[model samples]
Target: MPASVVASAGSSPAARVTIVLPTFNERQNIQPILQQLLALRDRFQLELIVVDDDSADGTADFVKQMAHGEPCLRLIRRVGRSGLSSAIKEGLLDSTGDLAVVMDCDGQHEPAAVAAALDLLIARNADLVIGSRFHPDASIKGLSDKREGGSVLANRLARFTLPRYRQLSDFMSGFFALRLDRCLPMIRQVDSQGFKFLYELLSISRGNLMIEEIPLTFQPRTYGSSKLDISVLWDFGVSIIHTLLLRMVPRRAVSFALVGLSGIGVQLLISNLLILLGFSFVASLPPAVIASACSNYLVNNTLTFRHLRLKGLQLLAGLVKFLVVASLPMLANIGLASVFYARVANDTLFAQIAGIAVVFVWNYAASSRFVWNTP
Candidate 1:
């Protein structure tokens, strides 16, 4: 133990923690890493939980051996499993501590950073305390231009689309601290699809989130190749879409409703363009409405009603169902407005109101019943 550690250990508060580190093909790095973690038992008073996803290289055996004599260490192997994000989810579901800190199994995330993250969480009451490698005060040693550029560009794009998370400079860093109850719901918001946990979390959490960029010297891993790649980037984009829509809508049929928004955009765009081309209000309205309806039909059929697509019969049935549902609103809009104007209400405002409300109920029910029937 370092002499400085001896001084701090003698004076500190306690927050019993369960440290979850997910691993795959990391046997050579396991024991040495656990040694460093064990040396800090007195520092943070943590229980180390190693979650290994059936690593083909006997990584689980390595952890099992190291954890045997160490009273604070325990091993949980998820057999026939692989994803980093899912492993952490499984670990948290099984963890005993009220607080859980997840860090990369690779040596890249320094063990000391975990201690720093915990302190920041305790002092500031931060929902999350991220160990940022790109912060000016950070002690990054082995970061290349490629890594630096990737981090910057990714965070910048995410900021533009997701304004709430933009304030955080280190959205991609996985090393962080959180109380487990708050952490569970945030983790569930993250799909099993991607490894970018922070990207997904920021989309849903409205808590008093204070992100601290604790600059730490990032050391390159001495053993094992990097798992980060293009898939991670693709997942980042997926995380953004899921996070944004999930927040805007409810679970029942909201994703389907969001798909309808694109149809609305296309509908308005085409209608305006046709009107600009010197078509009469009466003549232009039909073509504009027809064009928009056609576009909406195709989009909602394929994208919005995706969950209902299973067997050939199911898809065909769903298509028939969607057409009937979509047609009712649209027909009622122009038909009711045209008839009512000609026979009863001469006011254009009253006619337009009649059409809009007709379409609203029509679309809502069709979407609720026919389009999104999977859930």
Candidate 2:
């Protein structure tokens, strides 16, 4: 956390804001970004927080070398901390602004739009104000139809699936401003996982959602390849599921446990198949355990622990950690089942009851700390 995220945000008192930009590999666009913001600073002298997730293209360095103590402009060089939404969360935590505006660092999300969004937030006392491009008169430029359609589909799905969030044209756009406190608390409940921070925000948007389309062209990024991929798509799908299934932390954990149960079915099926094909009972167990762990990894990585990809290591470490943790439950099950089978010659049900209870705490504690942890 840097002081720019907060220290200078409300320094002016009259019109204080913290504009947070999440950047990833935008070397060629950083200068144009600063120039545009500097121009907008003439209209409003607000603090700026540039949260860069260790771009290999030297984006953070350019900002740091150029923007040294330039009053209201600061850059946070966050290494190992990746993803746009996660970067924004770091910025918000470090921010002290009454209003927080998050945009892109690729010179795409226009700086001038902040004026319109902030005006709406201040006048209407709105909880969230989105810079919509879907409005009829809005000048939406420089994007492919496919890219545009993807957003439309995702946001439409968001509104449909989420009962509380509705009537918003641009639910996926990162360019917007809102009351800092309202949006920040939702982070605790937010998945922050994968790429859709805005979706997570919209998922838990409890107060009024004020959507006003400020007609402005969306310029294409001038540098670096887009981070959107199959993983992003997978995460988007899981985000909706998580939002619909569980909207709170406790509810989310319970839902994950439910999903874990389904994983057990697949694991057992695979293990039994391997055993039927001439594998040892112990050998079959690894296949089943590994299969279940893999399934859990896919779902949890894409849905639960996505935002914490601060480092690539966290992903691999979490999986290895999962295997280590899963061993406890596996041993517990085997030991209980062996004793019961040997003594009563029956009562498999009794063993299952004891085994499940023991594993519950082991899985919960390990997953909470190593898997879907927020802080």
Candidate 3:
């Protein structure tokens, strides 16, 4: 077994520490990482749990075999549901420990850093301790400039949503430790449907918790491809919108606004595409607006108002209602935007930007109250 040490702590020897590693198709990396974590049992009363989302690559089987030999290692094979946040939540709820640590199974997160995070949690008495890659002493290796740039942009954008977490240089880091009891309450309050849970946790804590950051080098992945994709980025964007508007507006309303934003993007893209295909700009507007509304209704039904979601034939009915709810706003968006463009000196961009803002507020209010207003 590789050398693994527990950070100095004041807790009794009997006090337990659980490390929850969420995995999917991590067959190549699971065994060695488990060996490293299991070694920590010598210093701290430790329990290692692998919460897997039914990886097709034999991740669960590998974990089961390891569990038979090591009494401290446990595996929870999730069958139906998937996602890292939910996997962590399952492990956390089932954890029997004073402190719980969450880390990636991709091997980018150094196994040795776990002890350092625990050290900060013990020494600083922080509610949460993050393993940051952007810290002064941090070094990120093997990531392309584009990927690193995305991380930098995401970290900055997340800060805008929750200023309390602004102190964190790496909010996107999946490695962190917290008191399981303190985290449970906040976890319950957050919608952990998305990729990043730390943002939700800090947003729930509302900038009031005792948080600390520890510098660590982000090592290059030794195996498997990166899971960071456009969908993950979209999830992060939704999380940011949810965090920002959650403080003042109703959840459904915020979701409605977000869905509308995506619809607007779809509309612009389709309209431009039609224009490129030789259709007159004016003739393309109606089809673009209609297409966007239909997509928005489907997205809103499934994601925004998911609790009151419609299906099959009800979708056809919801589409009609969505068009009705969106009709006036569509006309108003165009008229108002055109008026702004005509009045404003040389800024056609400002006109559409301001117009969309106005129409968005109206659509959220009208749609939430009338179209899908299920309590």
Per-prediction RMSD in angstroms? 8.1, 6.0, 6.4
lDDT comparing candidate 2 with the true structure: 0.68
Q: Between candidates 1 and 2, which one is better according to TM-score?
A: 2
lDDT by residue (5-105, candidate 2, tens digit) is 23332233344578898887888977877777765565455778889988888888888877775778888888655777778878887886777788877
Query: TM-score of model 3 relative to the true fold?
Result: 0.74
List candidate 2 segments past 4 Å from native: 1-14, 123-125, 181-191, 209-211, 249-269, 275-286, 294-321, 331-361, 367-375
lDDT of 1 by residue, 1-375 (tens): 222222332355356668888898988877777788776677566688888878899988878876678878888887644577777777777777656688888788888777777776666655677777767787666567898788888777767766765656677777777776556777776554353766656665653455655777788887889887654654565455655565554422343445455555665566557658876444544555556555555555553433233346765565566667767676777677667767888754465456655576457666556555533
- Candidate 3 lDDT by residue in tens digits, 1-375: 111223446444534789999999999987788888877776578999999989999999999998888888899998866778778878888998888899999888888998888878877767789999899999899578999998899899988887766778988889999877667788776665654878777877888789899887788887899977655666777777767666566645666777777887887888779879999655666777788878888887777665466778877877777789889988876677667756764454455456668877777777766777654
Candidate 1 lDDT: 0.65
Number of clashes in every candidate structure?
Answer: 2, 4, 0
Return the candidate ranking by TM-score, descending. Answer: 2, 3, 1
Ranking by lDDT: 3, 2, 1
